[model samples]
Target: MSTLGGAGTPNPNKSFEVVQPPTDSISSLCFSPKGNYLVASSWDNQVRCWEVQKNGQNVGSVPKAVMSHDKPVLCSAWKDDGATVFSGGCDNIVKMWPLASGGQLVNVGAHDAPVKEVAWIPEINLLVSGSWDKTLRYWDLRQQTPVHTQQLPDRCYTLTVKHPLMVVGTADRNLIVFNLQNPQTEFKRISSPLKYQTRCVAAFPDQQGFLVGSIEGRVGVHHLDEAQSSKNFTFKCHREGNDIYSVNSLNFHPVHHTFVTAGSDGAFNFWDKDSKQRLKAMARCNQPIPCSAFNSDGSIYAYAACYDWHKGAENHNPQTAKNFIFLHLPQEAEVKGKPRLNTGRK
Candidate 1:
């Protein structure tokens, strides 16, 4: 298959275009709801907000504000109402920040282990989080304590919540979908062909189906309703290699049927869900990708942070640890006119 952008087209290899953050190893990246800013979490225990300008321009100036954390920041999410930003970290804490006032962060720690993932449901004013503590908790911004908690058999790596429904992927290669409306309800778990852990999960824009990427470099697409049945449809994505490290990150284009994934091998791939074809593969970073996020309009611009695996290496080394902002353009086709043939040849 041709590369993501087009066939025979030269790839636009852009540099990181770095914006100074407190740390180099960014654990997560999130585009704010308004698309005016980006929130990044670093292993250095800080969350920095960068202002994004219009016209696909480079980020303006340095980060506007830095939110301090007691431990390494793991993941972050922006509220739908655009009022607050939520962050999770290794200290087992989840924080909420007011975006209007220069990004002031308020600690809302309630988990027992490192919080791995968080999502906000603005319609209900609820924040849901998944943690390495083997549990999922629901928090209401207005309250100090968790409204409810669901214990899982394994550590949760990533989670996405859509109002009353929540989907969580675990380190044990299990995908659990829960009905948040009933806090006491048992989670519906779906098993995958690959026993490796799930690194990321993303739901379809229309909530029709969802995709899950595993550490084994394989992706499975499951129909929402069929996921609970004994028989389900699961497709393996990348087969180039299967080291089972981590899928790292996954994001769907807001307006397109395509989605992109990055992983341990630094392989960035785009897939067509309808055909399940590997659309494109780009240059590998030779490092582990920690996180990736797409811009608001679902344009080509996406950013990913790589972690330094070398021992005793500087965490912020520009060469070793770098954040990539890749620009993926839409595919184009050439029109060829049919040649005319002589009707009467003597």
Candidate 2:
């Protein structure tokens, strides 16, 4: 594993580029809850997995398996057992790959339009998918048809699930929340705190609330309880003077609970929502980071740097655009929350 061009000097927090990256832009990156197995879905119409091997201070990766879809894959999720991965794509279909068996993907779900996001609900053993067709479908892997469907206010752009809590960010600045205990009816529907289109949404580790990022380079923290509405707030990030960039992804540290936001500006930062402070900000890469994920223990951080097509296809340069996934060893201080200062007449 070799560190790439970014910081001019050597630093532990700096990223080491992962080998055998996707040929096209990366749409999503997910780490298995059980281990360091990373599964990535890409616009190349393929889903690939890699096993991150860490030896003392040195780190490396081994390619695991690959699966293909009829169209670009937009999102992927791992089964609770870590033996299987579910991926949805622009082909309007979702496929399940049993990695342990090295078996071919089996079509398990479908949408009227391109599926934008897919997530596995371990609590109920159901697969939920959000699509541009403006519906959320829950699938039971045994059947090809969805077991249940819920309509959305608009096209679904992003979806996240944590047991008993699910949040869907849709077009027209719509934010839909679901209490997975019911898993059918909508728990709440509200407008996005940000004025721009939602780029990503991630649940807090504790499942109390979620963080939503918008195309305008801003993130909003909203609590589920209306009594705590006063605590709901928003912050601006990934901005350089007059240039603002879309926040492409938001992932929480599994242990520390602090979250990181990757953006189109090629920068990512760790933030403590409770302390309302940024824990650390890393150096910006030369290209945008479309997606990122944190390993189960919160020791390893992975991010993909490439053109996200935010500027449209006309601006994409096949020769100049580079796609690489970087594995970073996050230091404790860089991710841990700041201690609350003691203020008293001692």
Candidate 3:
């Protein structure tokens, strides 16, 4: 257990909750690539933005913009310039909203089923969306239809993109890898290392591999290369005695490469994969942290604490559900990896 913070010990000075959070549960949170602007997609069929204003040591936010879909928005991503945001949702439509333009949301693409994830691939200059229809679609944005559609093993549960690398996790514990250079074809298809349902996946900062989180409260470190398979491993987390919770989201630090995991346990932990040690463990909140994201500079860590609907309708207490978005400035010592001790013997 890392000592920066433990369960039931939240330091008000180190973190602040964003005011005016979504009325309903939040589905996804993403920060702009070029600035402090943050966008959140929610179960209320709305997408909202906040400008995180920073002055010296204090950080705060002012609501900037809001948009809506016919149904709840599921995922969001920012364009390379950070001026535009793309969101997809239960409406089975992908909409592109250019924030700086003060323009109307445009329909860029559509899927047969609800779009579960959307991401901007700057290198290819295209927007990719994953859907429960068991397909991945690439959109050119200028055109109304997707440029191409690639089949997936099953309905996509999560998708992560990092430059030339893209990984899609789907139903039945299927994992598909794609090299964006040949964006339309599957590079490799494999089974998830974890035995349970895949909850989320995130690419390594270096794009060498990815981290997969499962419903069993475990995470798997998988490398793309077979030669590096020796380094692959799975570890348990977000568990208390006999009770376990799903690992809802995984995010990598933009600069340090260390990663953070937010879970249905209502807690988040920062871990250094290289050192195989946890850097920090955040005190658990009253609700599950359904989503999280790091800014372009990794200066701010944003997480959403709300009812994730994981345990189904019977457990959800709408009257008591808490929806909060928190911003925490992680200390270097809490996210940076420690130097490995050298033994005299080889």
Give per-residue lDDT, candidate 1, residue 40: 82
Worst 10-residue lDDT window for candidate 1 reads 2-11
- Please write out the lDDT profile of model 3 over residues 191-221, one tens digit for every residue: 9999999999999988899999999999999
Candidate with top lDDT is: 3
lDDT of 1 at 332: 21
Model 1 agreement with the true structure over 136-214: per-residue lDDT tens digits: 8889887878988888879987876654666788876778887666655755777755567677888766665577878
Of the two candidates 1 and 2, the one with more favorable TM-score, higher being better, is 2
In model 1, pairs of residues that clash are none
> Candidate 1's error at 100, in angstroms?
1.5
Score each candidate by Cα lDDT.
0.67, 0.88, 0.90
lDDT of 2 by residue, 255-279 (tens): 9888999998788899999889999
Q: What value does the lDDT take at residue 216 in candidate 1?
A: 68
TM-score of 3: 0.95
